[model samples]
Target: MRLSRSFLPTLKENPAEAQITSHRLMLRAGLIRQTAAGIYAWLPAGLRVLRNIADIVREEQDAVGAQELLMPTLQSAELWKRSGRYDAYGPEMLRIRDRHERDMLYGPTNEEMITDLFGQIIKSYKELPQVLYHIQWKFRDEVRPRFGVMRGREFYMKDAYSFDLDHDSSVDTYRRMMLAYLRTFQRLGVRAIPMRADTGPIGGELSHEFLILAPTGESGVFFDSALEEQDWLGEDVDIHDRGSLEKFFTGMTSFYAATDEMHDAEAWAKVPAERQREGRGIEVGHIFNFGRKYTESMDITVSGPDGAPLYPEMGSYGIGVSRLVAAIIEASHDEGGIIWPETVAPFRAVIINLKSGDSTCDALCEKLYAAAPEHFLYDDRAERAGAKFADADLMGHPWQLIVGPRGAKEGKVEIKNRRTGERTEATPEDALALVMKTQG
Candidate 1:
């Protein structure tokens, strides 16, 4: 994408309202703009990054046998009432009334609605195990919505619901989801530790919140340092194998990890002094095994093997798709700007035309841009070299290819790694080859 044609409204100075690094960097980098207190309008650059993150999330969910289906942002109040939560859910629920005086609401979560839908189509044990997920916008009336998307009132989320016939099957489904979450966070370039957490309004006896450690995080976490060394993606665990899933889950949970609410002094003392890890962490995802909470309340039932009526056990898994944009920034950014992970980066590399009008530089940049247009963002504007460099760094493309007149004339360009700040001088052909190799 050409900078001249792009709608990036980057600011030179930080906005006073942004209190965190991700919030301040997001504004200065022109990724998002606040339309209301906690609502934001994602711009072109921001939308690209958001879509990339969502795609990765979708792919990971699919890998775990979860099917994708979008749900509406607005839901009938009757659904919540059926689950006995309409009154229990407090002010955060955005209650409304239609012209007909019927109650309605912008859903904060979809447990009740999903249960109603599943009950409608599934009436027998034939569909005993199923996972359905949707990526959509959700709203919560936060009394104090701040820190940009981190605690936004309106944001995008991916919520998945799993239905099984009994407790054993439901536990298996929950274990599979835990594995999926670990892999998803690993691919997003963040080490998210799974810690036992309170279900809060979701009302589940079993729950886990995946947290990414950051100094600006809201909750205090205590975990074993060994949790950081586990390579979830590298582990060989077949999602469809029950024993494999159970073993993997047991292995992962063996580490001492818990949020402040669930912290146990006796357990903490058991860990080696050097292996004790404690810090502030931000929640990026959560999973819950609510069992028959909704099914029992809403009178949802399916036929059992013995032909008896049975309430299906259920579990819900959630990943903060929009909040991840800010979380990634918080976990990865430096003094310059966000250092995006390649998997979720808007573009793999950016090409800077140091001398826009210079025939040599223009020719070199155009050649590189055409080589992989989808993977590169071409800076063709007639801007100073310093400004171009600053903006490139701020956007945090994994690599920056510099084509100055002198280097272009010599048939050489400079390639700089955004994370390491390492520069290499090579011919345009050599640079392209290097960048393409990294793309793999």
Candidate 2:
């Protein structure tokens, strides 16, 4: 991906409309562009990051045995009517009418539709447990859609619905989702703590919101530092084993964690003084255990083992896939620009040709880029060295492979880690080896 051939439209100055750090950086770095109020078009680089995040999400969901299936962006209004929330849901629901005048909607969430669909497919306890998920675009008519993708009216989301025949099994499904969310965030290269939260329009008594710490977050957060020490990917819990999931859930929830709306001074005091952590946090994902709310309201039923009709318990889990792009920037950027976690970085490293037209520098850069053209963005534009350095830092590739004439002439390249600002001069082969190892 050569810069001369790329569509990167980076800005030298911040846009006035961007109020938050993520919003400003996203615009200045040319990752996204506003097409309408609270709506955006993701550019090539932005889409790359979006896809990377979704892939990690998909992998974790698959690991937990959740089946992947895409659902429609447009849903029937009748689905919501059956659940008695069509009108009660208020203006945020983007109500519309087809040419024939049928009531329709761009889905804000998929509970009603998923319930109706699930009821039709599984008719007996023999199909007791099913967890289905989809990643799709959704729209909500936000009265004031602000803060870029962080609070966009239209955005990409990953929503999963789980159904179980019994309360005990349904709770276990909820625990499994909790485990999945923790591992998902951990792999995305951020510390996201699960805090008990309001179910809101989703309507669930049991819910948890995962918030990643950031100074620009909308909510105040308090938790025990111990939550920061665990490595979820390294966790030993077996998703298929009920006792294993139960133990994992208990161990995780044992640490006190809460958003300001649910904060308890009594519980906060109980945490060791050294363990108390207070900061602002941005929500990236949420999970709910609503039991029979949707199933009962939609009158979805299956035969029980005793041969009587039964309503399957249901839960919903959601991650703001697009919003995460912004949330991650909020949590991980510095004065220069975004410092991406390697797992979600659009490109693992960028090849900077300090002297673009210079024979030696161009040759060295081409050599580095050719090794993994798909994973590296090559700055081959005829530009000044200072401008090249600024753009590379602003774009925030995890590493910068510098090819100046001085380094290239000696058959050496300079590699700089964006996060640590560490630079080392090495043979081109050695530099590639180090980066490839880090990437692995």
Candidate 3:
């Protein structure tokens, strides 16, 4: 993307309405714009980041054998009514009457709807176990929606539902999703700790929420650092193998991790003094094992091997796809701006032309960008070098290839590492090679 032609509207001052770092930075950096209270229109750069996150989520889910299928944003109210939750869901749910006076809702979650959909397809135990997922927009009418995408009324989410024939198998599915969540966060270049959580309206005894550490987080967290040190991406396990899953579950749960709501002093004291860690955490994902809750409520059942009707044990897993963009910023940003991870950055590196109109400088910037046009953002605008530098830092691409008349005359490109603030001079070819290698 060229700065001259791109829709990046960066700001010199923070927006007064943005109360959080991620919110303020997102608006000032031109990644998103507020279209309504608690709702936003993702600009080009923001949409690119969202897609990168969704892709990582999809890859991890697919690795665990979950098939993707999109469900609708508006769900029939009858689905909730059948489960006796229409009245219990409260004001957060946007209930409406369609043209025919039929009750409908902008879905906050898809438990009831997915249960009803799956029930319509499988009538027997032959279709016992299945994991289905979709990445879609969801809405909840929060009375006070704040913190930009972090607590937005409308946001993108990846929600998955698992169906199994028995309780033990359902628990295994839950474990599989736990691993998937770990791997997903790992690939996003963030460490998320899984802590036991209370399942709010979802209704499940077994639940866990993945929280990324950040000073601006909403929850106080206590845990051993060991939980964040695991290499989930390197783990080898068969999803269908019970023994392998049991070991994986035990390894993950062995660490003491909890939010303030679930903290235990006795357990905290058991850890070595040096190993104890305390911080604030923002929730990015959650998983629940609510066996038979939706299936029984919605009469979702299949014939058993013995020819008896049986309700399938179920679980639900969710990742805040859009919220993660903010959560990652919370966890990773510095005073300058958001230090994006290479894998999720809109562009891996940005080519800043310090002397835009100078013949040598322009030629060098063009040569550097042309080397990896798709992966580079060229600052082709005729702006002052100071403003270009400020915006480059504010946008936070991983690498900054700085070109100037002096260095360009000598065939040298100055490279700046965004994360480390390290600057070095090299030929255009060497600069491109370094950035591309680091991107990999």
Cα miss at 302, model 1 (Å)? Answer: 0.7
Model 1: residue 419 alpha-carbon error in angstroms: 0.3
Residues 354-431, candidate 3, lDDT per residue (tens digit)? 887898898888888888888899999999999988888998899999998889999999999999999999988888
Q: How large is the C-alpha RMSD of every model relative to the true structure?
A: 1.1, 1.1, 1.3
Task: List residue ranges in candidate 2 displaced over 4 A.
Answer: none
What is the C-alpha lDDT profile of model 2 across 403-427, one tens digit per residue? 8888898999899999999999999
Off by over 4 Å in 3: 230-233
lDDT of 2: 0.92
For all predicted structures, in order, the TM-scores are 0.98, 0.98, 0.97
For model 1, what is the alpha-carbon lDDT of residue 95?
99
Find the 10 residues in a row with the least total lDDT in model 3. Answer: 228-237
lDDT of 1 by residue, 1-440 (tens): 88888888778888999999999999999999999999999998889889988988999899989999988999999999988899999999999999999999999999988888998999899887989999999999999999999999999999999999889999999999998898888788888999998988887799999999999999899999988876655457988889998888888899999989899999999999999999999999999998889999999999989899999999999999999999999999898889998888888899999989888889999999999998899999988989999999999899999999889889999999999999999988889998888652
What is the RMSD of candidate 3? 1.3
C-alpha root-mean-square deviation, candidate 2:
1.1
